[model samples]
Target: MRITLHEVSKGRAGQALPSMSLEFHSGAVRFALAETEQRPTVLGLIASGRMKPDTGRVTIDDTANPKELRRRIALVDAPDVSDPHPDITLAGVVGEELMFAGVGATPLHARRWLTQLGYNELASTPIGNIDPAARVRILCELAVLRDGVDGVVLVAPDRHGGSPDGWWRIAGEFADRGYAMLVIIGGSAAVALERMQEFEAINASGPVQPLVLEAPADADADADAEPADEDAEPELSAAEPAEAAASGPWVAEAVEAPEPDPLEEEAEALREAQGPASSIEASDTDTDTDTTENGAAR
Candidate 1:
């Protein structure tokens, strides 16, 4: 169960999300930086094959079978999309999700299932009042209940107000069970995860490398066409990434790869549109504080 996003981006220029290229396979958790109110959901939708990117494409196991992606990938807790109502009781939420999973869906069944999970005490509480880590755990548990779901895209768990590590550990647990995991989160959460990464981390975050795009499809012919422009693009070939489908367990060496200039140029434009914002690589957590987001869509 591998998932790849090849330069997959949504919206037009100066809009929701910037171009992103990443890969993650089963038993690994991947994170992407998306701070805006809409970027997280947009990325989740695109990654889960529920929506199409305006530019690039989404693939599972190196094939462009989005329909299969829809079946195998579960998009969890995306606001205004898959999220349960804030006012809904925990039991109500469980019952509804159980219905989707084709299980016993009555209130009693939901309560019994909650008991099995040791969460019966919270059954009468509103889902919005659930702790952030517990919320992620419950939603994800229900998500994997679907027949063919082998992976999960958990969107904006940071918005719920908790230590990023709380939900990160929960996601890692699912990945350890052989489910591919992609968590779309704010820049601050991404920074937190990157900072916690050990030299040889066991719970590694997949594909946090610098942006590296693949060479164009007609590389052989195109390479020869620009012979006169050799000095102008001296480092382009070396900067090309490790093919389009490099999906597997997270590796530190791969994340340290240098990026090409073309993606940097486009990313610069994206930054200008986003105002003064920090990238996921920013070491200072203070830099991710977006006062300007009050004026924007945030």
Candidate 2:
């Protein structure tokens, strides 16, 4: 899915916003610099299709369709539209959003949801006091829970106060997960991010510059990789295990040797109890490797 705002403006005769054009599509996160306290949010609302632009148009996949755009794009942290009440407890916020998401909305369900998101301990904390990056993370997670949401317009996260890298990374992760993301940020925040780009190899994949990793990947693949012939599969199989040795130690450290089935393990333990005692050899495990994974080490 892709969303594009073409010279879109809002408010009295477009005075509220000068025309601005920007585009973001599935598997990408784009940033827009809006300095005013309210323009940042207004831009987000326009980008997400929550509010109609008084001037140009916002389109989904290059077609002018407000309903579809609104359905697919989640307006995250838009002031007065999606922001949670400052005083609401974290659990309360989750419960309310789950209600909107048509999931079970009971407190127990909310607690479980937060636990899975690794925010269980913050359940009782006021949303206002939560860390800014965490606030953006939880809110973005909740926004995606709504059916049909495949994109997010995160508004003014910098206004919450923290390094732009914090929430920027989070947005990049969403994009990596195949969600189209647009982050509306302040001018100073954008400047800071510009300086940050020197030392960090951040995402510049957006048509515009300035993107983050909070899973920022472009699915760049080796187009040059040669496909093996069908008859070569058996030949390749013999060498595959040897090739896997580079990842062996890392994989082992990530995952312990598989346990036997329950009954077998129990029998093995029983046999060990009856067997004579023997000294166990110690092995070094501090080795490191360049192995990488999209999945967990374990």
Candidate 3:
């Protein structure tokens, strides 16, 4: 199945989108490099079936209603919309997704996919326990659990640092398995795109071009638009790495856990040893009696 968007335009906070059009063929992979805000608007419009092009149309294999094609389309790792809860177990996350899509969560089916994706060990682990790269892999595995998935759109694939070619490899895998893949990267993301010769790419992050607005009397009608700052680009220092994301596997920055005080630890241990009986007594007894007992003990 193919998906096509023609002349689609959207506005966020009154800023209009620039001539955005996309086409994803079956068993193919496509990439879109866009500004942070613009990516979500375009992706959300396609996912929710609410996209109405100001001039053209969005169609999936000739079908107009995107809602009807929901079963065959999957949006994985989309910012804000489809993010997996960090606290949920990996299995729980996938199980809920399977149920939502009306698929059975049998051990064989679930395990097979997880293992194939090199994530079986993390199945019982919470999503927060795994690295960002692993989280992306898990979501992709969940997308193909049901049969006949025509397309999968991944937003902000560069959030997790991995092989510069990692996403392209994953997309190629999906394409080989008969699913069209669309990977959206943020304009500010540090990923390198030189290795993506096999995929088609669209650049949507440039300065917004003038378009005939649907409403003429909107804001900024008289004010001159400011020119982009040429000096905004940072000069690289000799010590600073040019491409950090491409240098190695991105391990998240470690947070310094507070050291435990001995007194606090002892007090906590004492409370645990006292167990439910102490808690019950303190809660159930009269306030006056408890105060008197505390004074007598002291």
Show pairs that collide, candidate 2. Answer: 169-214, 170-214, 173-215
lDDT of 3 by residue, 1-298 (tens): 8787776665543244456778887788777766755556465456435455455567788777667556677778776677777788887787777776677766565665577767888888988677756666667877776666677888776766665476667777888888878777765442356434423343435555788756455446634467657756444457866465234344245435689899999999998987656345545566535435557742
* Highest lDDT model number: 1
RMSD of each: 42.0, 34.1, 37.7
Better of 1 and 3 by TM-score: 1
Output the lDDT of residue 186, model 1.
91
Total backbone collisions for each predicted model: 0, 3, 0
Summarize candidate 2's per-residue lDDT along 191-241 as a digit string, tens digits: 887787754654454455557644323333443457666644233345576
| Model 2 per-residue lDDT at 226 | 71
Error of 3 at 83 (Å): 1.5
The regions of model 1 sitting more than 4 angstroms off are 199-298
Q: Who is ahead in lDDT, 2 or 3?
A: 2
Pick the winner on lDDT between candidates 1 and 3: 1
